[model samples]
Target: MLLHASFPFLKEASYLASIYPQIYLDFGLRIPKPNFHGLMSSVKEILDLAPINEVMINSSGITFAE
Candidate 1:
């Protein structure tokens, strides 16, 4: 099972992912949004509970061109 768009629920998603072995987190559209500090903090928050392997990144095959 995957928790989609986890950026909006970093804490909850991370916690769930940490507790459930079959659960994974996906931070869709999150890659291009945050700056260095924000990105670091977000990752830190996730890693605080969820394992690195349980966290996934998916762009949904969509790109934001600016």
Candidate 2:
């Protein structure tokens, strides 16, 4: 299962993904919307618990600017 919109629940999502083999995390554009410091912290938090391979970065490429 994919963890959608997981920024708000980083600890929980990362923990689950770290323990469960079938669970995966999808961090869309949520992490990039913030400033540089925030972006770094967000990534750090995710990596703290979850394995690097279990995390997935997603980009739909469609925005609300239209």
Candidate 3:
């Protein structure tokens, strides 16, 4: 499932994904919007609860300008 920017829901999402083999997480808008530390912390939180393979990187269709 594609999750959006909901910091508080991180734990729940992780827990659910861990139990449900079909459930997946997308680190899209949530990652880029946070500060460096916040981003790292968020990723750590997810990793602590879910397996690495269950997570997926989402670009959110956003491109950076040079």
Candidate 4:
């Protein structure tokens, strides 16, 4: 899927946090959350980085490679 939030719902949600915290209560928007861009960046980093096994081998020694 294309990396992004749930379209207009999240778009409108952006305003809900600032403009109307009360709207959150009205719409059950609890626990104000991070945005799609933040989440996407984190996911991208994980996908870009080598696996932990590879990292361990590189950082320590080949004997402990997974």
Candidate 5:
């Protein structure tokens, strides 16, 4: 869900060849693949942060409107 530049995948990702063989020798396509354990560990750390973890599990969203 972390689509921003701060996503760990971006940091570790390197340019890779395209899935299909390149027709032209100019360049190749690249895609980002995450280090799954690294990403999950970060998420686990955030979830362990306290009552935020508990509230997050039971609630859909919070609203201030009355």
Candidate 6:
């Protein structure tokens, strides 16, 4: 399943994805809207818990001008 704005629930989401192969995470929408530092921190948090293959990068609603 594609999850949106999953930063705050990274731990839970990661655990779910790790045990259930059907679950997948997307770092979209909410991730890209934040500043670079915040984005990196969020991504790091998610990565720390979830496997790399289980997570996908999304640039939705993101603009270079931001």
Winner of 1 and 5 under lDDT: 1
Clash count, candidate 2? 0
Model 4 misplaced stretches (Cα beyond 4 Å)? 1-33, 51-66
Off by over 4 Å in 6: 32-34, 63-66
Rank order by TM-score, top first? 2, 3, 6, 1, 5, 4
Q: Relative to the unseen true structure, what is the C-alpha lDDT of residue 50 in candidate 6, on a scale of 0 to 100?
A: 76
**Tens digits of lDDT, candidate 3, 34-53:** 57788778888888888899
Please state every model's RMSD to the true fold in angstroms: 3.3, 2.5, 3.0, 17.2, 17.1, 3.6
Q: Candidate 1, residue 55: CA error in Å?
A: 1.0
Candidate 6, residue 38: CA error in Å? Answer: 1.2
Model 6 is weakest, by summed lDDT over 10 consecutive residues, at: 27-36
C-alpha-based local distance difference test score of model 3: 0.76
lDDT of 2 by residue, 1-66 (tens): 564537688888999998999888887655545587886778788889988888888765657656
Candidate 3 residue 44 C-alpha distance from true site, Å: 0.4
Deviation of model 1 at 42, angstroms: 0.4
lDDT of candidate 6 over 1-66, digit per residue (tens): 657536578778877877888888887756443588877777777788778888987667566675
List of clashing residue pairs for candidate 5:
none
lDDT of 5 at 25: 16
Q: How accurate is candidate 4 locally (lDDT)?
A: 0.32
| lDDT over C-alpha atoms for residue 8 of model 1 | 67
Can you tell me which runs of candidate 5 are displaced by over 4 Å?
1-34, 50-66
Which of candidates 1 and 3 is the stronger one according to TM-score?
3
**Per-model TM values vs. the true structure:** 0.68, 0.76, 0.76, 0.26, 0.26, 0.73
For every model shown, the clashing-pair count is 0, 0, 0, 0, 0, 0
Which runs in model 2 stand beyond 4 Å of their true positions?
62-66
